[model samples]
Target: MYIDGALTDGQGRIDVINPATEDSVATVAAAGFADVERALAAARDAFPGWAATPIAERQRWMRRLRDEVIANEDDLRACVHHEMGKPWAQTEEDWDRVVASLDFYAEEIARLQDFSLPDRAGTHSHRMVWEPAGVAVAFLAWNFPLLNLAFKLGPAMAAGCPIIIRPSNETPISAYAIGELCAGIGLPRGVVQVLATETYAAADALSASTIPAVLTMIGSTETGKHVIRTGATSIKKYAMELGGNAPVLVFDDADLDLAADVVCGVKFSNAGQICVSPNRVYVQRSVLQAFTDRAVARARAARVGFDRDDDITTGPLINARAFDRIKGLVDRAVAEGATLLAGGDRPQGMNRGHFLAPTVLGDVTETMDVYRDETFGPIVSIIPFDTEDDLLRQANDCGQGGLTAYVFTRDLARAEGYAAALRYGEVQINGVKYDIDLPHGGIGYAGVGHDCSYLALHDYLVLKRITRARDTTLFESVNA
Candidate 1:
């Protein structure tokens, strides 16, 4: 972990295992309570100075970090693959997004600089200024470690807030690599610190501590709730991107092929571990079989193996725990009478690694656990709806407020209606595209706060309005 702009080691070491081989990739030390304390203290002490730094200079430092990320892109991608088992292409895409986010902060900070407001009637003037929300604590999940870090880091830097990051224990190598890059770039001391704890205790300390004015996390909804409760002690602001059980809605008039192309692409990505991956697929009765057939075909075509094949789209699950859990869900869904249209068991010639067949199920009901739960695996269940209204109702029945939704229809009127009716944060009209300029987050069970776009900077900033009266007005205090 990088603490106060210096390199440091933890008390004890933990083994990082490769999901594909179960082999020890590297040993990382646990950044214990003392490390957490010092990191938080350094961030707290440097907040005033860092936040007061001129925006232009801050941007300069930010660009340097961005340059470092771009320069060491290969190393960063390799770290993610070795530690977390993500495929090479997906890791590359993640870095591309990371680079874009860094560029975004540099570009967006300029527009956020104007803070002056003229007097209403020439008697008073106001200076509407934005101050960085003091020391920020970010909880980075393992699935997309570096990309998730960029989600919080870029905005915080642009907002002039010093930050402390708690990376997931399962994927700490990339976090350490990022720290090395930050240290080498010569960032101001304490502006960025990465905690290398072996457990969640470090995150607990940072969240419950009174130093940080803002706390952001990317994890499950249950975890988000815990952070909310703990952070309330200090009245800390929050930005959380939790779980999702995304549902894809296809109408009778929808283009079946287009819907198939989009759903299959997203459902199979990252071995279906994405937070907003399409899980509960709701298709109209008219095109249900056609969509299901296409999905199953795509699943069979997707390559899964014990080794990293650039040709292989599916990587092994994080570990044995994920493997068993996903298998259980798939098995139970089948037992509950959901038709296992495609894959229902482990692949042939894959007994050593945590590998499962890219699965698809049809004739499912909302009552099934597979439909209601966030199936963070390479499996998708298709539920056909008898009517348009019926399908909309079932989609709304999602308890997690799935973050992303999809609708494929030739009729613009029908698409508009469905888009407005969906409860999720983003509704893709006909396909999938993750753009940095767009805002991403969720509602209901998905949690709250904005994580992308210009709104991300707002999450790390506080607005203050100061006014001066040239002469005493009607409502002005006459005693002063």
Candidate 2:
């Protein structure tokens, strides 16, 4: 664990397993309650100084960390690749985002300026200034270890807030690798702390503390609720990117090949553990059969393995538990009348790892669990819709809030209408794009605040209004 400007051992250790090999890749320090307290205290102690530091100086430090990240990119990528069994090519996305986030936020923070507010009565001058909120505690999800960390760390650091990061135990090695880089770059004590704890008690200790003024996370909605409930000890700013059951709408006028490629590309990527991965794909009934055929073919073509040089597209699920859960969803969906059009079971000749082949299900109904719930796996549930109204209604009927929605249509009017109608943070028409400079967030149960772009800086910042009475005599004299 990295705490108080140093890398140190904790009371216990966690053995990190490679999901692809089911082998212990590395053993990392696990924080106890005491270690959690120490990290919180360190963040509290460092917040004032860090927040007060010059923005230019802070930018320099951010760049230094980015450079270190680039220098050791191979090692960091290896950590994520081994810890999560993510394909070597997929790990590059995680690594790229880490570098891009730091660079983007560093430049973005420099553009922030106080806003002058007009006084209606003209008696006073007012300015709204942005400042660091205070100490922050970030809880990261395991699916994209470094990418999730980058989402929180870059903005918090750029906004001048001291953050204590608690990465999921399942993927702590990559985050710990980041801590090593921070230590190497000589980041100030407590400005950034990375720790993982096996016990929920220790993890809860950080949330239950009074020091953190901001509680941010990238995880499931249930876990978000738990953090909010436990962290209610203080009124903290919450910016979470929670669970998503994203929907994809493919109209009859759409490009069937493009729709299938994108859906399969994202669905099979990282073994479909992505929050914004298309959960339910609704196709206009006229083209349902055509789209299903394309999707099934793409799923079958996906290469599933652990070989780094094999251009592998799909890798193992994070663990046995995840594998079983995904398989259960597939089995139940089939039992409930959904047709298993493509790969649905573990790939043949792969008996060791928790690997599931890229799966495609057709003739799915709204009543099925796979359609109702977020299927965080390499499975695509295709449901056919007859009308536009029915498609929109079913698309927005997600019990879990909307994060991202995809629309593939050639008609401009139809695309615009769907974009407006879809109740999601992001609505991609005919394509999907995400970057560190683009806003990524959700609504309702999905999450509360933005993760990327300049908007994300607001999560780590507080606004203070300063007003001063106008000098009446000076104004009169100047006018006279």
Candidate 2 C-alpha lDDT tens digits along 1-480: 999999999988999999999999999999999999999999999998999999999999999999999999899999999999998988888999999999999999999888999999999999999999999999999999999999999999999999999999999999999999999989999999999996999999999999999999999989999999999998999999988888999989999999999999999999999999999999989999999999988998899999676489999999999999999999999999999998889899998899999999988888888998888999999988888766788889886578999999999998998889889988988888999989999989999999999999999999999998898788688799
Off by over 4 Å in 2: 472-480
Q: Flag clash pairs in model 2.
A: none
Kindly report which residue stretches of model 1 are placed more than 4 angstroms away from their true locations once superposed.
113-122, 306-308, 472-480
Per-residue C-alpha lDDT of model 1 across residues 1-480, encoded as one tens digit per residue: 799989888875778897877888988767778888999899988999999999889888888888888999989998888887887878887677678888998789778864778876898778888889899999988888888888988899889899998888888888888888889988889999987676676668889899999999899988998888878778888898999888888777877888887787777778888987888888888888888888999999988863446787888888899989999988898899999888777788877678788999988887788888888898978988887657777787777476878888888988888899999888889888776777888987786788879988889999999987777564566655
lDDT of each: 0.84, 0.93
